[model samples]
Target chain A: MSHTLHREGRRRDLRGEFIVMSMAAKGINDAGAGPKLRRFLRIARKHGAVSVSDVKSVMHAVFTDIGAVESVLRDLRRARLGLSVTVTGLVAPIHRACCRSEVAEEPHTVAHSLGVWGNRRRLPSETVLSVMTMCGHSLVSVPLVEQAVASVRAGVCSPRAAAVKLAEPCVCGIFNVDRAARLIARLARSGKRR
Target chain B: MVQISKSKCVCCHRCALFCPVAAIRSGRDGASWIDEAICVECGVCVRNGCLSGAIRRRRSPWPRSVRALFSDPVTKHRSTGVPGRGTAESKTNDVTNRIQPGQVGLNVELGRPGVGTSFHQVQQVTRRMAKAGAGFEEQNPLTHLMSDRRRGVFPRELWPERVLSVVVEASLPLEELAGVLKELRAVERKIGTVFSVSVYCRWADRRRMLALVDRRRLLPQAKVNVGLGRARRQR
Candidate 1:
């Protein structure tokens, strides 16, 4: 028998675990068993390949194969929404997983206390952090990047200084500071605030 | 396959209760049996749901090693001897010297959620990049599959193998960025599933990329990562 697909319009699932209530109340089960919540999130991120950051919209279907996933992705594109089903995975229905530890920001290993971690005044704000953390690898957050874009746009920061500032956060060297500078320049000048 | 030990399984069916793909079934004896065909080896049951430590992974032979490759975070990739996905290509480039000054590395990922790649999508890329004289990063998982790094070919035996995602990594001259983008787009419609591409370059290289991106309308979805953790040239 083919798998049943469930469609959930974009909901901000930061942890990717919240369950659909109607299905849960009906005992969302496959065969005789159900899917666990943690399993759902894992399958979703690894399989769906949708940027979990500011996803804006999502089309979730379970028990579906590549053909079905592809169809839904095509449908979303047809709807003029910017979404692509890059990956797809399974998610079970039962809850009981506290998975925050699995993907928490790396700051936890160094800071002895949650308070200390939160008090990291040097860290970027929720607005910027929300934007920066979308990369998942944690190499892209540079205060100098935003500052450099603004400065370079205003002729206040030299291009050289801007490059240094942009490169500062890239310890892993994967973060493309160069492309970002250009985007930032455009965004800053346009006042787009991205 | 994910096995639920008969001796250990309580028949609570808790572990199988929420199987996303219906891979688990109640046996005649009330024990849990996971269908090999349906199982994606996601490990969610063993990690979070198993209460009696009853669920265990049977040793995956040769090609299924692909599953273990992406599933088990600690399993060191045989080809590169690096643990967990591309020597942390994005995580350790500064230390590894995989990326260099005036150059950028492009990491392309091809993936499925449960069912994995058959090495077809990956081969398309390796062939193209190798043809371009680009070098695949030694520590990357996809490079591990390459029997000929220069040809971007995986071992013939691995052609049917599957995994969650494969990162094919290559470093190139910054000027080749557009060409790389073009190459990827050429193969975009050929694959069965979807993918993402990341270009790793220096801060000084952003303007040129921006120009290319604007002209070509490529990588509008790509996220820019500035390594905030790196030692600053200024500070």
Candidate 2:
């Protein structure tokens, strides 16, 4: 249940959002995976992962920079812990990162979201949708995102601070605070221009 | 599944603003309460926490407890032992080989973060897919609740259960992609909530499946399983 997929935004904006999930399958390898998984989180944290979840089977982390993600991926490859690692983000950069790390094994599978299909009218504004969808499970509410944008626009809070507040709602710890700050800033600027 | 403690509540109404579905309501005096019928039991109001320590989660009964199972990420589904709404296979397609070269896995995800869905709405999409000759995945939690897999019907008692979102999983031969999309479009009008479609297939067929979907609606981001895990089944 990776919420990392189906994140909506422009390619340029999405370049700032990347999520990595490392899993030890229940039957195949979950036994005694605690230490290895902890190590995975450490590597992610060392490389400046904005958020990290230590959940055994569904461990994952989010990063805003391609360099950090590539470094973590490279470290995982070197570990050879035999865990299944999946990265979600823009296709080109992800492929480039995987290849650079020498983890781009052949016969890979690609899953694409055919965006929201029904009741488009019920969705929030495009900018709000972009930020909230980052949380995947929708823990980040529409009002909270709107409030953050307003706070930034009114100069009540900095984009970085608002982004941290926005990240508090996502329990999975996959929300990228850096990317969120950039998006919140964009929304605030757009609102001012309007 | 959660309520505002009147004794502890300072009438701040902070939780109301953070509710995804607007299930939390505030009075003119700033008193607040959760609308049980509207709550999906996602625990977002509580997870975000109440500043006054006013939020409390009450024990939910059988069918009602289903909400947390499907909506709460930490609550593991007893049916599948998987922690999220969908199965692990959906995310680890390459590792499991669950969706093979000759078949297409269709994920009809109903509901969004703000707009939750009832089980009855999910049945609408499942019935449509079943009629289109799609076979539901056996390990999928949604499929485990089906009272009649052949017709994709859920028990009458379960119709009212709500969740933040759910993925109705099913698969069919690669040749039936067009027919299934047509059926999905038909049901899309009747389904009250918004949902997204995800198609999973072998890496070799990515372009083939992409060619069939309307390019305008595809999101910019996509998930690629880089084959890091040892395949369970040999190709």
Candidate 3:
């Protein structure tokens, strides 16, 4: 199929999910999902970049039925599969997953990988904190920075493990563990690892 | 000069919602119309706010009927304000090009210069102008324009430009100062023009403001001017 056709199909699929998610979350009978998604997509494409915040805002407005898992899947599929999804929004889902995971080992690995792959583009504080809390850290701060050393020590998850888990679904690009580790260490010192 | 078609408007109200001046109004037909007199012509609504092509922009008034006039330097300069064909060179010449050390806080009067201004006022104005300059550099023109007048440069270039004398009023917060500097650096990359800031403050507080300027020609032309009556007393 032509790229345009492929994108239209994917948009239709996303529109469906957006409707389902909105209905589930808001308990509303409104059928404006398709229009809303189209609007969001149009704006995102026009801007050429979408932030995690953008996805979260739309998802929240849609009533959060688009859970972290589905969103992450969508983002990963978009990024790895070249699905023409919003770039920042695609990264947002994975970042959201990293925040919600309960396996003490996964969140840190994801954070490190994200830091390396995303480079200096900082992830939203909520996403970082969600990941930290998922790995068993306290939720004392809604969007505050947590001490990397304390969080890691509390969770007992190594950085290498975190990187590996994050790199798995990223089919398009390989994550460099060494680079991730170094970036993580630097971020930790600068109190920015989160 | 754009007309919004009511039939095509979705009544998303995005245009009215984001109008900086709140000039857009929703009509009975569900389309938004701009109050032409109050519309600042910022174009924010036309650019980012309008999702539907309902807004149609009309060109501004024309100056002439002849085609040859387009190449005339005087006509072009009069039309654009910035000199025709030599905008880059003219901008370079408009301000003193030298970046003098310890000049960051120099208090230089922009626009019509007059009295009743104290050192404290000058410092305040300079600080605000610097912050605004920084904000402009950061590509956060909205924030810069909306920032406290004491910490922002009154963009004389903006349409419907008002004539108001600017004076440095007071010292700004340190973090804000740093943010302003960072913004200036960022702007330098975009506009290719370095801003020369002027700082003014009480003689006793001079050192403090000077420390902030930090020997950079970013701030220069520091001076003290007596208020209207005080100027006569000194004379």
Calculate each model's fnat, 2 decimals.
0.00, 0.71, 0.00
- What is the per-residue lDDT of model 1 for residues B1-235, given as tens digits with 9 covering 90 to 100? 5688889988877556334334678899998878775564656567544678889987677776676565433345464455456533333232233456667776665552222345766787668777766778775666766778878888777776555456677777877767766766666556664444555554345445455543332311222111211221221
Candidate 3 interface CA RMSD, Å: 30.1
Off by over 4 Å in 1: A1-194, B6-32, B37-40, B76-80, B93-97, B112-115, B214-235
Question: Candidate order by DockQ, highest to lowest?
Answer: 2, 1, 3
DockQ-based CAPRI category assigned to the predicted complex of candidate 2: medium
Q: What does the lDDT read for residue B152 in candidate 2?
A: 96
Q: What TM-score would each prediction reach against the true structure?
A: 0.48, 0.93, 0.25
Provide the TM-score of chain A alone for each candidate, in the order shown.
0.28, 0.91, 0.23
lDDT tens digits, residues B4-117, model 3? 777778888767644434468888877688776445343445654677777766544422111111111112323333222111110111121111222222222221111111
What DockQ would you assign to candidate 1? 0.02
User: Chain B of model 1: TM-score?
Assistant: 0.75
**For model 2 chain A, the run of ten residues with the poorest summed lDDT:** A24-33
**Prediction 2 global C-alpha lDDT:** 0.80
Off by over 4 Å in 2: A105-107, A192-194, B77-84, B231-235
Predictions ranked by lDDT, top down? 2, 1, 3
What i-RMS does each candidate reach, in Å? 22.6, 2.6, 30.1
For residue A83, model 1's alpha carbon misses the true position, in angstroms, by 36
